[model samples]
Target: MRKFFDPNLAGANLKDRLLACLGALLGIGLTSVISAAFVHPHGAFLLIAAPMGAAAVLVFAVPASPLAQPWPVIGGNTVSALVGVAVRMLVPAPELAAPLAVGAAILVMSLTRSLHPPAGAVALTAIVSGPAVLDAGFAFVLIPIGVNSVILTLCGVLFHRFSGHSYPHRVAGIAPAPINAALQAEDLDKALADLGETLDVSREDLDLLFGRVEYHARHRRKGSTGGFPTGRAA
Candidate 1:
């Protein structure tokens, strides 16, 4: 309970939150405007899907996450939409179609290494959207879903760059200086394999984090020893 209520759970500072909000507004707003202009009738299917809103959260708030990158945004949503449409066409029943679409989308995204969480919502939308969406067919993947994804991604990139945040973050090629020399790439890989669960952070970022923590720990230990040798000289 104490851990759940920890102040650190709040995460980002005021400035970060402000930037994220602004980015979401800009991305979603522009995508909506574009969507409305092109998608005719402009009723329920107009503009963007509900998932795009969640995508905006990742794009703007957690730009560094692997799931928030350009490929993940574009490919994940597009492929999921495609899969959803396919499932809907084949499976007439909404009950079966909905779950199948989501599952298939997840599998495709995982295989493609473009696993964005919101893509599942996009898949669901494609299935349960009724006759209007079904009539639109595969074109649905291209126009609104694909277009919205591309636009949102572009907006996120521009917004993050302007706001001094890194969008489409690249992992550093060189590893940070390690305090524990025994900590190798293989060790990290083995540890991650042991965990057997997907983490939001990229491998590079995790490695950097471990390196920093070890460095801090070593410094703290040295400081506690008053910068003098702890053991007697031989």
Candidate 2:
């Protein structure tokens, strides 16, 4: 029974956790209100997409995640919604359409390099959002899905900046070389393939993380002991 629990629970401190909660409150609230103002006719589920709530968890709490980035948040939700709307229209059976929409969403998000997990919810929501969403047709994709994603992303960016955390946390910069010889890029690639499941983080990011960890470990050892030897070269 204990094995069923998630081991990797979020380890954020109280301050960071509170910041994420506040950000979610502001982001979702603004997104719902602003979106509904524009699409007042069927504003309930149509304007205020349910998936954005899941998105808030990613954007605010897990700011470092690749899935939380702007492109993934926006593109993933919008395209998945498109797939959902298309599947709903083409397939008359709700049972078939629901699963098909989710599956197609994974495929499309993979090809687009925008695989945000909340997008799965977006696809499923689009299918079961009732006649109002169905009647909106393709326009639904742009109005609610696209509009909501953009607003939420914007909120994340602004809030994170204000809270002194990087919003689009994925940054390009010169990084130190990896000192750990055992963990190569090729090895990570093979491990990813063997897992046969999509990992939320990129291989490059993992590499960088490992490299930084190795560098800091070495630095700490050198500082602690004057005669400490260097680590083996990779």
Candidate 3:
């Protein structure tokens, strides 16, 4: 049981772990407060808790994803909300409108590079929740949904930054993996073909995340095997 609870070297520092946990909690709490304060929705499903839970999962389980970041959380949800409202106004058939709204949300988010996972929830809420959401109208987009996103993102940025993780991570000065560099040098479509793996996430995202993991694993083995005087090297 003790062995199973061992920490990896890259994240072995106790303070860093504590900070990560704190940041995640703050992110969740801030969002929840804002969601409840405004844009008061009826069901527990479309409430702020949903997006906060989704964000918490992203922070802990999938921290490396671009989709997990602050911008994605805010922009993605807002864009989806707007799309939903537009679909409600424009499209006559929701059977057709629902899928289109979601697709439009995805397209806008991806193109704008703010692809948050919970945005799908906003779109789904817009279509399924029916008249309540429509009646709330633009207020739905502005008050609770948009308001919640901003508060959540602000919390995320502050928490991640103070916790020693980068927020709104700058791409500059960071060198991508050799494979990614090579891929980008070529066209994205062709590069994906060459990789020969079916990835659920974007190929570029997958590459960066895998590269980070591999790099950490290598150092973690060194720290555990070589640096730990209490343990014998296996």
RMSD for each of the candidates:
5.7, 4.4, 7.7
What local lDDT does model 3 show for residue 75? 81
What is the C-alpha lDDT profile of model 3 across 41-125, one tens digit per residue? Answer: 5444445635556766565434555677777877888888889888877886889888988899999998988887788778767
- The best candidate in terms of lDDT: 1
Cα lDDT tens digits, model 1, 104-179, are: 9999999999899999999999988878788888888887899899999999988887987788896543443444
Q: What value does the lDDT take at residue 135 in candidate 2? A: 82
Q: lDDT of each model, Cα atoms only?
A: 0.83, 0.82, 0.65
lDDT of 2 at 221: 72
How far off is residue 137 in model 1, in Å? Answer: 0.3
Rank all candidate structures by their TM-score, best first, as comma-separated numbers: 1, 2, 3
Give candidate 2's error at residue 123 in angstroms: 1.3
Candidate 3 or 2, higher lDDT: 2
Q: Model 2 scores what on Cα lDDT?
A: 0.82
Ten-residue segment with the worst summed lDDT in candidate 1? Answer: 225-234
TM-score of each: 0.86, 0.82, 0.64
